[model samples]
Target: MTPYEDKTIKDSLREERKKLKDMNGKDKLWYIWEYYKIPIISVFVSLFLIISIASAIYSNRFETALNCVILNSQFTSESTSPDDYFDKGFRQYINLPEDTKIEVNHSMSLSFEESAMNDFTYAELAKLSAMITSKELDVMIGRKDSIDHFGKMDGFTDLKEILSPEEYEKVKDKIYFVTSDETGQKVAAGILIDEADFEKKTGLLIDGPILSVMINSTHKDTAHDLIRYMFGL
Candidate 1:
């Protein structure tokens, strides 16, 4: 071989050895990403699409802007002016104060699976994980399993702290509370809706699911107002 060709080969081998040395010292996650980049990219893409589509839907519908994000099994509320609609129909809006005229907008997301311990996949939790990580979630209305799942994630605010003394007095006896043992501290992981209210509204006498605020919610006041409106407080 030519002298210049020999030098070029040695330089290339030195660079390859240095790269190998660096790669050997890389963290576990770096190696995992390198090996599973395609799947990781797909998961993130799906999560981004979910968030983007939800954002688009919210922006287009609520020009007044979102007051909260509700992650529920299903969304039932559609009429933005429910107070006005019910007011005209049942003459009940007058019961609410004039200050309750806030235009509360919500971005809702459905659960990926029903059970927290079931055959749920990582991709299923992608949207939820992303939302919580972004600190954008406000309210979550869901079942005990979901509450337990998120409560373990340590992202949900303690409802006991959020509810006022008077309000808690009214609701304390109505709903059921689920306690979670976190670092030896017993925290409320979930709360079922008032059985009387559920039966009155849905005609189902069974005890129902829960609704709680997110720990990182930006619109706590708005969330509280919506809750008051919902429970007819």
Candidate 2:
């Protein structure tokens, strides 16, 4: 009501306004936090949940690698095992765009014939064969019996379609071509084993383990990469 009191009050209000106008970054942030705290907390919580779910899904898919399988005659060598050859000296061997476990223990064995030195239990092999038919199988590495059995069944993919020109040249000598009964057309069945142990056993490069991708494979990109890798590409 009085002039002096009113002037003092106006001066105080002006000072507060100037302080607000000249607010620093920290002060500005605090102002936002105070006014929109509830919404800010909600946004962060939603983001946290989204990230968590995405991480879990990625982890499961990455871990499973969609049932990468290898049904083969069991390895029996004095100097090395198939497991060592694959899992060891492998991680640093190549830098892939995606991370694969490259494991060879349970991942590599599926019982086709107990007579062929297979390690897979009956139940396990049955499950694997189901995955193969479903096109969930990523890769299959097997010996002649298994390869012949699967290839004739039209279970394997033709490598010719996926191989680059240079790649075809490298593997042309190594791959086996078979006529699938269903299509009556020739396709690559598998790659012969080039490992040293097999050579030592036979005293020469002969038919051995064959690596292949499936025709209806879901992970076709990764499967192609693996078939190329079989030839050291």
Candidate 3:
């Protein structure tokens, strides 16, 4: 049979469909794959490239002003959105730009006790380590043991360095000290939030929460402002 030399897309589709209609299941599948594989693969590749570019743009669109993680807390985003109070209020308080973003993550939960450690706890710990290493973490709010664990690793910035003399004096009584494993010297690693109206201000409730700034945080001034804002210093 002589094939049409100038077949249009519609004509080709029609011819292919007619051929497929006469074939059995395996033969039809093979024929379609042999003929249509390139187009199918092209469509998927285009979609993947579009998605990758879009994701890159979306992720870089907003500048993160502050990133705070609340660990081992009973707080849930479902119960109270951080946008309603923490993020909104802080942006307003600091007079940040509209495009700036604040993150208040309370989903992480960890326990140091061997019996309490599980896969989820390990995963959260790994995530926390990565965040610290990347300097994505600004502030960490956790209990004494949790703070101590990171403190021993020298993960937190010294309060004296980040805080002014007057600011340090104000919170000196509430400072949480930890013996650094490297230096074997006591360092002011965290601030005890016992006296602060933390729950009232941030809409988060956790007993004996300690606030510590990451050693490599890029937003130290903002982190300092946050500490003073929370402690009312």
lDDT of each: 0.56, 0.65, 0.86
Question: If scored against the real structure, what TM-score would every candidate get?
Answer: 0.49, 0.56, 0.84
Residue by residue across 1-233, what tens digits does model 1's lDDT show? 88656777779779656766676556555766786799999999999999999998766663221233333333343433323333332224334443332332223334435464233445546756786678666666655656767776666776677778888777766453444455545465445676455444433233255777777877676566555766767
Q: What are the per-model numbers of colliding residue pairs?
A: 0, 0, 0
For model 3, residues 132-178, the per-residue Cα lDDT tens digits are 99989999999888999999999999999989999999889999999
Candidate No. with top TM-score: 3
* Candidate 2 per-residue lDDT over residues 96-182, each given as its tens digit: 324566544334454455575344466666777787767667777666766777788888878877788898888789988877888
Scored by lDDT, the top model is 3
Task: Give stretches of model 1 more than 4 Å off.
Answer: 1-121, 175-181, 194-207
State the displacement of the C-alpha of residue 178, model 1, in Å, after optimal TM-score superposition.
4.4
Show pairs that collide, candidate 1: none
Cα displacement (angstroms), candidate 2, residue 14, comes to 74
Give me candidate 2's TM-score against the actual structure: 0.56
Pick out the ten consecutive residues of candidate 1 with the lowest summed lDDT: 82-91
Candidate rank order under TM-score = 3, 2, 1
Clashes of 3: 0
Scored by lDDT, model 3 comes in at: 0.86
